[model samples]
Target: MPPMLPPLARGDIEEAADACAAAPLLNCLLREVGEPTGDPGVHRLHAGGRLLRVRGERRPARPEVYADGGWHRLTHPELVKLAAEELRRHTGLSNSELPTEIIDSRDAVAALLAARARATPPAGPYLRSEQSLITGHPHHPAPKARGGGPVTGWLPYAPEAYARFPLELLGVREDTVVEEGDTTALDTFGEAPPGYRLLPAHPWQLDLVGARPEIRDAFADGRLIRLGRTAGPLWPTAAIRTLYAPEDDLFVKFSLDVRITNDIRRLWRHDLLKLRRTDAATASAFGAVPGSAAWLSDRGYRTADFAFEELAVLVRDGLREHVVPGATPLLAAALVEESFDGSPLNGLTDPSAWWTAYLRQVVPPVLDAFARHGVVIEAHLQNALVAIDADGMPVQALFRDAEGVKLLPQVTRAAGWERLVYCLIVNHLMELAALLAERHPGMDPWPAVRRELTRYDTDHGLPEIADLLTSPTVPGKTNLLLRWTGADGADARYVPLPNPLARH
Candidate 1:
């Protein structure tokens, strides 16, 4: 059995987990519909008329609400109940399921915290950074929800617990195999019998779909055969479905049945069919951009015809070839969350200089990609990778995940621009800026962001740059409202929030 976590009172563990869970939900509730009540820390829910407040800006904690003539502290379940009541009145729509997910998300965090107490983190800084997102997607209410599964079902594959395991190798009979683009890397994993092609599978995914008739039929008919597991373990990255094999310098993205954050983590067939086109466009766009910035291409994917979406494995370009020499690549989300071990942001003595270097490395590539190539890369925190040199300053920016990439005419320019602003500015820059301001109090990071945008305006001459600089409000994705309304995860809906970068 795995070593047990260090002894802690169960109440203490649950309290920490509740705090972890409440922050994001409160963030969402406050951002979407709650009205500020003069006091900077307090807000009134427009729908339910409940007064809510918390401490801290980046990661709000110690939640309380005005009730029964005094402020009452709320437990995780109580917070969920408040959220459900407010969202129902605000949206005028009832949702029973989202409330459960909010609770499940809190429970999942508790499990992760307990498990992490027992396990050792990976020695490699990169691995440590990838697995450090205990409180993920700061704006999403249920960022840690794991399909409400028991801890045993999902904990072994969780990145938060520093979990690492071998990829399950399989042989797909050539006659029944389906593939596109360059999947040559798959063959290097292991050998297959004659007339069979090598295919690598995430063991967790295989377990999820193993009982299906098609999978069982293939196994019995000799159309599919299990070879063995990989010799080396693959580390699960911040994006749970994607695994990195450090030895081979390779990334394999698999289909997961569990709902993580907003969506069921599956590589749907439609996205797979269009992967090559989207990836090619992004690659070409990056090639023309002038800098050390890189786009990790999703080269191709392979899966059995019978279980296309269920078993699909996408091969993405690894960091080895793209990263600057002697620089370590860390997940931007982890860095923003202050979860990355030995984070450069923590050691910054010169806030302005470090912030400038970050904006220079990250801003230009994203703007150039959109303006020049009509490719609106999903440059969100999770998809963006920042490599820092020995001196602990950002040296390069690398972006990944072709499925999230959107081409210009495919989505109207207006729609694409909204997404770019939301992903790049609101999601990526805002979080980093908040954390920076929190660490170095009274430092306004927005002026530096404004300067970066100003430079982009001078270089690119895009009208949206000017509009963004002066706009009072910028789009913020409504994750709580989206889930409560039962909207598709991919269907993003945004409402305006006060834009910090806007000129006062």
Candidate 2:
């Protein structure tokens, strides 16, 4: 018998696929894989999430959810389709090896066991106290263990880890906090100056930062670290932040330069917000939406009683039970780090590694949130956060960069021009897909993502995310990396966006 999965609902698999913009293959996994024994071996798959499992010596098989009060046998061909789709989605093989291609239930179960056998508890991402932010790998132990797992600290301020990093490695910090009229700058000391407060940093943030830090430090002491002076990208190039110490338990992202501050404001109020209006309208048609301010509140997952602008908190740590690693335990799932290897997938050829997490979980929620709330959110990768679980399954997604949030011009009071639309569709989605492909190695990934985007379009009325990726040449040069169009708007045929990083 094949071993079981984490007792996932057939529904969850389907739901994940639906959001992934990869439903056909996801649906196939559920149907073909059958019931998850938690044992990986054999099972039956059914649409609408019917699952069945194998029993003892011809033991009457069991049902995860018995529809007619009994287990039902599914055809073998059905299983083929399911597995084929997953294989296609993940590995994208042209033919099955029944020899090389056919993955027997026994082998599948063994693979799961192997993964679990190698399952080491994950460490806390950052150590924190009431005053600082610290960094550590989920697999790496904390500088000092609290108990079994590791103690998490919360700090009032994030120290300067970036300060220690080489100047070429500028730490880009993007976070969410309330904005009143329309402007918020990166924090300097730690807490939001007088007008703002720090917000919660979601795990999905794992993939956000582009310039990788040479070293990660979470100061237990109140000491602050800063990057030594060097040169690479210009300061005002984008929103760069300091550090959020996990040991100290607070994250700080500061921008000493004013240009970084102004750009953030312009991107949000003038660009992102304008896009949100249209998004909110289009998303509502499919039942996905969220309040504009409330959307930013997602990182902290709280509603601001006062205006969002009135509540700017730095990155703060939530209470976590420190499980000291003595025996085996489940660490949070999905801890893959998005780093660039100077590979084709990086911005030079495709997207950076960060977008992989976004494609798998984050973007979908933003779309659904905006649709359900009758409010628009700029879901482009810039405004999105994506995180995953131990097994690499995506779980949490948060949206920030409120200035980017927009109200559809035609549908609401909010109005903006092509830049908003271009950014949301072309700039964001294309970049994310490119990044995801970079991380997975051999996978074309872009096509699988497009497959998923197509699934999204089948349900929601928006253009498949792919439709927006466009090149800048035809429209004349612009600051955006690339440009694309939405399927809903112009009547012209689809055109590919020229990637700023991709050169002839």
lDDT of each residue in 333-418, candidate 1, tens digit only: 88865445678877689988999999999999999999988999889999999999998889999999999999989999999999
Name model 2 segments beyond 4 Å from true: 1-257, 261-360, 370-374, 380-382, 409-425, 435-442, 463-477, 480-504
TM-score, prediction 1: 0.97
lDDT of 2 by residue, 1-504 (tens): 221122223424322211212211222243223345465444444333444443321112221333587745433334345444433443334434221112232222222223323332213332111101111111111111111111111111112111122122112222323333212222322343333333322111222221223213211221112232322211110123333333343323332211111122112223322433443343343233321211332122111222222112222221222122231111111121121111122233333233454354544555554444444555543344333344333345444443334454334522222333344445455444433444445645455445444566567755423333332421111111111111111121222334432221
In the order shown, what is each candidate's alpha-carbon RMSD? 3.2, 20.5
- Candidate 2 CA-lDDT value: 0.30
lDDT of 1 at 253: 97
